[model samples]
Target: MEPTTLTTDRLLLRPFEAKDVDAVHAACQDPEILRWIPVPEPYGREDAEEFVLRAAPGGWREDTMYSFGAFTKSGVLVGSMGLVRLAGLGGLERQAELGFWTAKEQRGRGYTVEAGRAVSDWAFTALGVERLEWVAEVGNEGSRAVAQRLGFVMEGIQRARIVQRGIRRDARIAALLPTDWERTMETPYLPARTD
Candidate 1:
């Protein structure tokens, strides 16, 4: 699938381009971003170049991931987001994982939330995604908060489900299903009852 662009009231979500390497490199330099995300410990220009020139486009070409660089209307790079780990594209499952990171100075402004909603909408409507999972290392409160605000129900922690920098870590897993989209359902749902 070719990479597509999405827009919100305050942001533009588009494919990363070579011109964005500098901005991407700068944003990845933040301590918070480096800590929470799995990028190289000391993110360098070469890494940013590889992401913009290779990885981003490769994922699109492979149809296994859809990554977008979120930017302010003025073209300032605000962060990155993606729908990855695609499954059941041609079957009944239809799911993917949602991941994102915000620029250090851009935190707490709701930009990520706004972009997230737009991306989720695209995944549900354009990509036929039924379930969008969000996983974050257990202690990443900011990520968890964004997922919760976007209405992903906290499904609990998965033991050692994540590996970052070669160390296994527990992850908080959450999900947003089709039924949760606009409080409507594409297919009828009869959730099991424990009572």
Candidate 2:
């Protein structure tokens, strides 16, 4: 269950490669990345190495998650996104959580949305997931905007449901159902201007 390659009009979502560790390390070192994600602070090369070697592979094989390295046609790792927290009852496992982050230099280009849209499609059609859940720190408007653009309906804020850097934080919860996805269709929104 190695993460497979996914594509959209201007992006390619693929599995992390050994060479991507440096880029991953660089992205993780961003304070915003450390702030929103539950990863170790002062993110270093070792942390990114371990993530690529252990957590990511295990996640994909368990069918519990899939993390992709977001690259451009020329193959530069600009970011990463994942379907995580997958769980279900009986033989049903149709729900998952979505999480992503872009490099500091690439923040405003809608790469997250493009990658997310690609994965959401795979999750629903290829993986048989029925619902995709999203949550972001209450004031993380950037992330919330991506969720909205991906058609995840805001379900509301969860009081102190997220703990970051030893502080309790509120999270905006949202979900996208297969019914809300246009299966036979590709993404319709043009990439928002980065400038």
Q: Which candidate is the best by lDDT?
A: 1
Q: How accurate is candidate 2 locally (lDDT)?
A: 0.83
1-195: candidate 2 lDDT, tens digit per residue: 656999898898987878888889988988888878889887888999999877788788887678899998898777889888887612365678999988888878888898998898888787777768999999888889999999999989999999998999999999997777755322233436989
- The alpha-carbon RMSD values of the candidates against the true structure, listed in the order shown, are 1.2, 7.1
lDDT of 1 by residue, 82-194 (tens): 99899986577788999999999889999999999999999888877888999999999999999999999999999999889899999999999877876564556678898
Clashes of 1: 0
Local distance difference test, each candidate = 0.91, 0.83
lDDT value, residue 11 of candidate 2:
91
TM-score between candidate 2 and the true structure:
0.88
Residue pairs whose backbone atoms clash in candidate 1: none
The clash count for each model shown is 0, 0
